[model samples]
Target: MGELANCPNCGELFVKGAQTVCQNCFKEEEAKFEIVYDFIKKKKNRTATMNEVSEATEVEKKLIQKWLRQKRIQPGSFPNLTYECERCDTQIYEGRLCLDCAETLQKDLQQTDQPKTLKEREDENKREKVYYNVDKENKWRS
Candidate 1:
């Protein structure tokens, strides 16, 4: 027999490998899951968009996207389960992190002017491109 674990939702005892509630409670969860899955599966639902999923399921958009990327829900099965960024709310189909967030973070990181000696700057300049922050924008300055 497998080790025991407390159900995440109801705190009942279940097998250790289970991450969610036990089988009895899982039925209730499955009902909700079916609602979401059904909503995503239908053609009208396919065009429903992330905002519609948020409104219908009350599940956070980010989490829906995570489920899609993790293959907990098959992409081919439901063609419309795409995730958007929590910050900018941009649609990102591939990964949990959005491209805009990545670009913004990259720009913010590059904006920090690290102090370096002339020789160090020259060596760095030789090895790679140099970026500078001007008017709150990142620009590659030669």
Candidate 2:
């Protein structure tokens, strides 16, 4: 079931459905998308980057990035269309991060997620332990 909410674009109260914005905003966005798509559909603009497309169409760079993330603007169709990597800001045609950043993130997550063995935990505990002994002369020895 849809819920009543304020439109993010116009701040108008509306029933939230497939889009986060209201119907009017959605229509406006659709029109903007058509403008962008039409510009990209031209043979000369097929090699245009996201920045180029945004500048040429007078669209927001962030909005163009969002469309790239959502795959509404297919990068495969345009040879030079690319978005920035979420981590390193490197240009990428697909996903949030480029291959290098993605691999590094995957490796870091894997290292963190790996469970420690009982022997490893016991070894770590042993390394952390310290014993002190007091002799007859009241000298502390470790």
Candidate 3:
């Protein structure tokens, strides 16, 4: 066993072993953990952005990310869990927006299932006019 450290909750001496703190402090921590876990476990709570979790749980985002890295919480179990991009309001699984967003602005480029714009129609007409003019010029020269 390692030397005792002061309990963060009660400032009491706690041995360094399986316990993070003294029994009383451990119990308090356990209770807090359960509260957070339960809040996240609800089906309605399936998807939680980092900001949302921070606002709801009152836990720091950095601390939550740390916990995730440590595997204290299994992200695999939470499929809908996502984080928002600082630049865009895109939902992302890990750090920021989805991989496609990182690569390019696919959402912006996705063609809408609608009619073509006036400019497109005008461009097509111009091409037809040009072809007609070329044929007329050829016939006059011949």
> Evaluated with lDDT, which candidate comes out highest?
2
Q: What is the lDDT of residue 91 in candidate 1?
A: 67
TM-score, one value per model:
0.48, 0.77, 0.46
Comparing 2 and 3 by lDDT, which wins?
Answer: 2
RMSD to true structure for each model, in Å: 13.7, 6.3, 16.6
Rank candidates by TM-score, best first: 2, 1, 3
Query: Candidate 3: misplaced stretches above 4 Å?
Result: 59-67, 79-142
Pairs that collide, model 1: none
For model 1, what is the C-alpha lDDT against the true structure?
0.71
Tens digit of per-residue lDDT, candidate 1, span 31-89: 76677777787777776766788789876665566567767777665555576666776
Put down candidate 2 lDDT per residue, 1-142, tens digits, no spaces.
7999999879999998878889988898889999999999999999998889989999888777778889998888997888789999998988898999989999999999999999999999999999999999999999
RMSD of 2: 6.3
- Point out the worst 10-residue segment of candidate 3 by lDDT: 133-142
Model 3 C-alpha lDDT versus the unseen true structure: 0.66
Candidate 2: residue 121 lDDT (0-100): 93
* lDDT tens readout by residue for model 3, 23-88: 996676557567667877887776776677778987666555545555666788666555456467
